[model samples]
Target: MTSAPGTYDAAAEAIAARLASGGAAARIAAASSLFARGDAIPHERRAVMDLACAYLRLHPGRDADGEPAFDADDESVRREILHQIRERFLASSGDRWDHQQIPLTLARTYLPDVDLSKVHIRSDRFLSGAWVAGDVELSHATIECGDAEHLATLDDDRPHFQLTGEEGDLHFEAERAAGSVSLFDQLRCHSIDGVGVTVRGGRVRVSGHIGAVRLPVLTATQGVSISGLVGCSFVGLLGSDLKGEVSIDLEPALSAVDISWSAVHGDVSIFGMALDHGAARVAIHLERLTVKALHLGGARVSTCDLAELEADQVTVRECDIDELRLDGALVDGGTIEYSRIGRLSVDDATLGPSWVRDDPPARVDWLGDESRETVIGLNIVGSTTEVPPQGLIDNDCVGTMGDLLLDGFPVPLRRDSGTARSGAK
Candidate 1:
């Protein structure tokens, strides 16, 4: 392609020819020269796409088994190439590449390792069914999807966008803005590390088989819904500040789930979760968590650490918990109905009646209520305070009570027997 001096067409031809014919070193030299000459040439999207395609064609990255090689050294070189292409060749004079609209769509395709770290994109990206060979480094990147109408036009029944890191994990640490990230049916990655990520006004939904997920120190203004995690070893959401609802639905055989030191403004629901029952006996950690309401259903965990929790209401229905700890918690009301709890501890906690008012009236499902709940060992010692009159009304303890320790009024021990006891220290 012949063009005038300092034209994008000329630069494109030069880069393409060098990548097609020259060796690796020669190709690098050519790309460097052209990329550094960004101030002289005009920035054209076609030229950028053509150069990227040429470089990808040069490194097809397939092994003898017809699979992506994903070699470490090759990935390093690819990262450098793409970085130079985006930063120098595609950027205009006196402008960083962060203010670029690079809309990309590669559905049902095969891609090698990708590194978009530190890049900012102001466009929609669709990678539905795209199989990535290696790691996807998105650390410090800003992804925005401005086309809400276009996103709404996508078919719901379409295949879930696949970001399978066959050889490596997905790195999302220190991300700036993840605008409207919707991973439709499921995501199949080896693992996801989203430490120190910030999602300003968008929601994050991922449902599928993931090896592990660590999203500690996250800040999300909107909600986060992650479900259908089958055989995932661990899920860590520690030290997060979520301003919306949080829902996590796990399988029965999960190892551990930790959401300590987090604050959620909306309801938090966890369903179908359990801990490892082997020799180690991993447990679920919810220490120092604050939420509006918490609901746990169909859970069979070894231990539930609900110490220092601040919530308006908490309900644990249809659960088979080995140990339920509520030490130093300030909860307005809670119910443990229709469950088999091994041990229930309420040391140094404040419990009250339900503040939620239903139109048709709510069902009475507290401890020792009409529900078919069975608590083996109950402990209410160490200066615990319950609301007057309505608190500890029906003492339906099927097992042993360590101490019927209360602050103010005398409480009954059983519904069948009229035994009013006062502070059995």
Candidate 2:
């Protein structure tokens, strides 16, 4: 053993030959002299993590699109060695790592509310990352990320997130994962997919139990609520620009709602949306609303509120609206294409080739029928741009059919018994 002196321990081979080389500022000064060395000697930080995993197995930037750019100066030397490992070995209570199973190889640190259900996130197959600064609570917790199918991709340099999970059975198998995930209002989760994670902003309250949530680029500044979803699918929102206040509560009459394309501003409520599971029929848009039946098949909506508005198989496509309201209404069946409804309201209504307005609305207010339950199916084939004065034509008004012609009528009728209804109490 005396011969071991010359066996190349030349000060641990000069810090493993300056962490194996001269590129990227000598690997950020040998990763700040081997993780700032304050691991306080556990076989000298496991011989500097076995010479940093043997120079990451002879480095091709350690594979997976050539890693090694946790940038911003390696997140300012990994939050100053995690504030010197939380002031030299984090232990103020039951194991913050004093129980010593700390593995933050490709480093980034912040562990605030610190209830990762007895944290054992050991992802060191070759360096991923970690962060949990404030409000992290998984009450029946589990974070089991030792080799989470080789998880990576979260070096956005965002070290500020408030996380919460409650009432037992909380788990995340993390891949490109997490921060800005909330499930309050009666939060009940036993399963929420794994390893395909991306969270931007969420609040699924109203007796919330979010089962299926998928996000590609969902960013919210405030207000996101969700509740009561059963075997539901809103089909992959194509051109997505949905912002704050996204309220979804679907589980009524056997739950059916599938939103498409997406360009909402705030306040979106969906309760008991119908017909889904790939028989493929879903369209939704309303302002003043009540529903026992609504079938908007090629859906695009700004607001829909029809109190007794049971328009069966309702459909509208290419919708670009500023306003369209029909109260105390009931018109059945659906189809309308290339829509532009700025202000079209028909109160106490009845009108109906399944009531498809082949692009109607510069402004029309029929103000007929308030309440006695008899306004049957409407088919208004008119208005190139706001016209309704041919006796304000009734039998549900008619003037043109095919390229839809009707020039001027109905500008003086504002009897909105004002049934002010959108949805979600």
Candidate 3:
């Protein structure tokens, strides 16, 4: 780790010295010896972590003579410190930390002594589950992620898995960074802000749940995904490659979800989701994407998508799609504009105004049981691609798109469609 502030305490320094002494085998023995002492009290253990974190915060990346700062030995010591925190403090196979015991407020308990004002935490241990009782900031800084050799020692359960999971109420905001991060297990956090952040590589499984999740101008390479999110505002997807089948089955409901200027490596399947009543604006949008399949069932999204969408009992309005292939899907007051589908097949599906949208459903007033959400209106018209000289709709088949789901709701959509179809109507 570069540009770190190192001030090691007795406990942290002792562990670092042990790790620096021997090779991987010797270090493994040292680690085994450390854990063999058994677990300490939650507060006591976190204090040890705080002491180590304090050291990291105070570490200076370079030396006075302009020589190699944090030499091989120093880097090894830093890596050992991170490994200690991960094995003893953060969650591995499971995060048995003090999340349940700590308060949600930052700095009260979670990483309690993190001296952000003094130094930043330059370790990969945070990728694992931790009950941070405070806000974490990697914003507007160059986040040089931990490297491979150091990351190799962190895999408690698997091989070469640097990140395993995260637990508790988390507030992570990242911007302008190099390197990568991976979410390898279930994460339960209330907030994750990744605005204008660029990650070289990342992986998000379908099991993570966070509230108020926001990502704008986020770019990642290859295997990048944010799948199966519970509820949050996904502002925009820029140069991100999402891969997975998503299912929204949570209570707080999904917020403004917008997807634009992105690529989907596989099918985007949405099923079983509802809107939270407390949400200010609510909607979903999909623009400028070249995806494979879109299967929607028991969901509610604002008119958005461009290819092969199948749905039932789902409420939508002014849907503009490309490559639309509907089989056993319903079409209420939605439009199929600018699609590449040569033939649109709708079988065993309803076609007309939504049976549920007679009354608008507010975020809190969604009309459905605990398990499913209800769709209201729908409209379809050929706009851009998937047409034979003439579009599926009339020449006046132009419409503007609305804001994303949840936050952008109360705001009306500014579309180019002469035939506007909104559930509010």
RMSD to the true structure for each prediction, in A, is: 8.8, 18.1, 16.8
Give a tens-digit lDDT track for model 1, residues 264-376.
Answer: 88988887633322323347789999999999876777788889999988888656677877778888876665556666566667766552212211332433352343442
Clashes of 1: 0
C-alpha RMSD in Å of predicted model 1 compared with the true structure: 8.8
lDDT (0-100) at residue 30 of candidate 1? 60
**lDDT tens per residue, model 3, 1-425:** 11112122345335534433555566455544443322433333433343343333322234587522444543444455545544443323254344322211121112321212112223322333432222333222112234535344332221110111122222221111123344312344555555544433234332354554455454433333455555444434544455433323322356455555556655554443323334332344544443554444433444334322322323323222222333333333343322112123332333444222223233322332421121122233322222221112221322223221211112223334543222331
Q: By summed lDDT, which 10 consecutive residues of candidate 1 come out lowest?
A: 169-178
lDDT of 2 by residue, 1-425 (tens): 11121122345455445444445565556555664552434435433443443333231212266533343443433344334333333233342332223433322222222233322333322121222222223222222233232222332321211112222221211123223232233322322222212122233232323343433233233434555544334312222344555555444322223333344455454433222222332333343332223433222244443333443444444333334455444555454443334445654444433445354343222312211111222244221222232323223312221111123123332124321222221
- For model 3, where is the 10-residue window of minimal lDDT? 157-166
Whole-model lDDT for model 1 versus the true structure?
0.54
Rank the candidate models, highest TM-score first.
1, 3, 2
TM-score of each: 0.65, 0.26, 0.38
Return the top candidate by TM-score.
1
Candidate 2 RMSD to the correct structure: 18.1
Where is model 2 more than 4 Å wrong at Cα? Answer: 1-186, 189-240, 243-376, 384-386, 389-425
lDDT of each: 0.54, 0.34, 0.35
Candidate 3 has what TM-score?
0.38
